[model samples]
Target: MAMMKLEHVGIMVSELERSMAFYTDVLGMELVGTLDHNTPGIRLAFLSYPGQTAQLELIEGYADRLPDEGQVHHVAITVDDIEAEVARLRAKGVRFLDEAITTLRNGARYIFFAGPDGERLELFQPPRG
Candidate 1:
């Protein structure tokens, strides 16, 4: 009952720099900060929108081999224009799992794509007014 809002979602990554670039350069998230995790051989990096507090934490050196779907099933980022966002990512060589955007019963549209570390990422558009 004390929970206020979703703070962050952390995903394991192999290479910190590469994953950071994918989220920052390709996805357009701003790099919040990077730091050495308490555990040895582990590093942490946080990213978010230019002026937002909620973050996506990228953790490195947690696992030697990552599964195809990675640890997290998928991380969805809300978008205003799903089509334009898909086109933008496609131009950057991003691979999508879904051939076309999926429309939900409530008119929400979404599409899944692979991240640098093979983590699933989704772009979602809520119903229009």
Candidate 2:
């Protein structure tokens, strides 16, 4: 049997430099590397959480883009405290899609937000028994 763990979540961005600033400076993810897909005009950047197994990939290109209306589909990260995380991000001038806390089917708390490219990003923390 083949076992696999999630390598990274890819987000498509219109402006690479702006998105890089948000993810690196604000979100605090370390820039891992950058690559070109060789499709005439396409570039991709990889970022990783400091001292963690998760990674985020930002892809910039001219192609079919994200949906017209509604929040961009998101990649979520679990934090130790949902409320505290939200507050911290809010203090950093990050705006959230929803301020109210929500409970998932499995009983976890989460909130969603938009990144620089309007890509949805979720911050969640699982409930303790």
Candidate 3:
């Protein structure tokens, strides 16, 4: 078993530039990086504050359904061992959304699961050595 820490909050947006500006300019958070995120229908922008707080993920969906639907997408929690954590959660009868773990350009590996209320939850790990 390993410690889990709150990582980032993902939000789907209509406009990437506007959302990025609002987060960086208005919110005063620094832009960590942007990526295609290894998945379709999303343009990922990761931002963070000055200290050890959770980062903000701006996800701009390809489809124009942001106004109708919602912005908040998912919550990510970082783990020391993603495989071990996933196995542990699975033993408790947790349902995984992804067939396999997803690794991004930054080397972070993660898997999505559903919370009690159907909210998307992520278990993340740093780039593997």
Candidate 4:
């Protein structure tokens, strides 16, 4: 047997709106679609970029149910407005992991944050110089 190609990454979020803001606004990913789907014991919203097949499945309805160890680390999302996005999200009450910002010698800047479900996520500003 052979494992098929990767399909998508599933992230169980405690709050949908918080995930939406970080993925859509902060990361600048299009909210291709969302739904209140149901199967047997779970439901979630499927999100992805336009013309992209792989998706980001934001699983919800898991209130305070922490995943097993090594559930997830963090996904790097490229952003052009690192400063502005950080400010906006901060105003929205999104606490960041690091107390300050960090910029690399390659002209790239980045920061980390904890998602609504305690999912560690990162935003990176590509090298512009």
Candidate 5:
């Protein structure tokens, strides 16, 4: 069998510029590159995490249109502090989909949010002893 690793998670956004500000300025992700596709009137921007192996790909499709509801599946990122991260994001006007932090069977804490285009994104931190 071959080994597999996650390269990036693609999120379809309605506003590329707004999403860029959030991911790059607020979240501190590096903008690696961007591609403009005229045929579909969409643009794709790739972001890389510093000192990490994964990336977040943002897709802005048809500047004048919005993606259908329930289009985004979800993207989860492991954070160092769930509360602190949530606070920081909240201060930046980020809204959470749920009020309470979700705890998994393995004792991990997480929260979800809707991105610029309504893409579901998650921030999580594992419990410690």
Candidate 6:
């Protein structure tokens, strides 16, 4: 019935490994995991405080160019029930970037929708036990 919490913020990077080092080695965040993204040519790495769930997702090979200020791919929010949330949003005329929901290798499901200013926003449903 409501969004659970902010899942993670996705950022576009030109180099996945470099960004991973900077975030983990320099910032002291722990590398939670990495995955070959479902999208071709794209890679993903997650980092966060040790023993905690990942709070940042770094993406590479998504785009050839990123602005000097950096690009935020999207802000993800966790939802208890993705299907219901999607339906609710659709009823309000929310614009979705894609029609199908994507399930990750770990069983996490997500879908992206356009925000008010066309900013990307994602709704994530973690794997259910």
Best prediction by TM-score: 6
Instruction: Single out the weakest 10-residue window by summed lDDT for candidate 5.
Output: 1-10
Error of 5 at 92 (Å): 46
Count clashing pairs, candidate 2. Answer: 0
Residue 36 lDDT in candidate 6 = 90
Error of 1 at 58 (Å): 0.3
Better of 3 and 6 by lDDT: 6
- Of 3 and 4, the candidate ranking higher by TM-score: 3
Q: Work out the TM-score per prediction.
A: 0.54, 0.50, 0.88, 0.45, 0.47, 0.93
lDDT of 4 by residue, 29-92 (tens): 7775565543333455557777885667676674457566423435656667788878878899
Residue pairs in candidate 5 whose N, alpha carbon or C atoms collide under 3 angstroms: none
Residue by residue across 4-101, what tens digits does model 6's lDDT show?
88899999999999999999889999888899978889999988988766489999999899999999999999999999999999999999998889
In lDDT terms, how accurate is model 4? 0.67
Per-residue lDDT tens digits of candidate 3, residues 6-125? Answer: 989998888889988988899899998888867676788889988746898888875577666566879999899988999999999999999999888879898999999899999989
Measured by lDDT, the strongest candidate is: 6
Each candidate's lDDT (Cα)?
Answer: 0.79, 0.71, 0.86, 0.67, 0.72, 0.92
**Total backbone collisions, model 3:** 0
Candidate 1 vs 3: which has more TM-score: 3
Question: Which runs of model 5 end up more than 4 angstroms from their true locations?
Answer: 1-3, 62-129
lDDT of 1 by residue, 16-126 (tens): 999999999999999987877545898878799988867887989988988888675457677788888888889999999999997755576778899998888778675
Give per-residue lDDT, candidate 5, residue 112. Answer: 83
Runs with alpha carbons beyond 4 Å of true place in candidate 1: 73-129
Order the candidates by lDDT, highest first — what do you get?
Answer: 6, 3, 1, 5, 2, 4
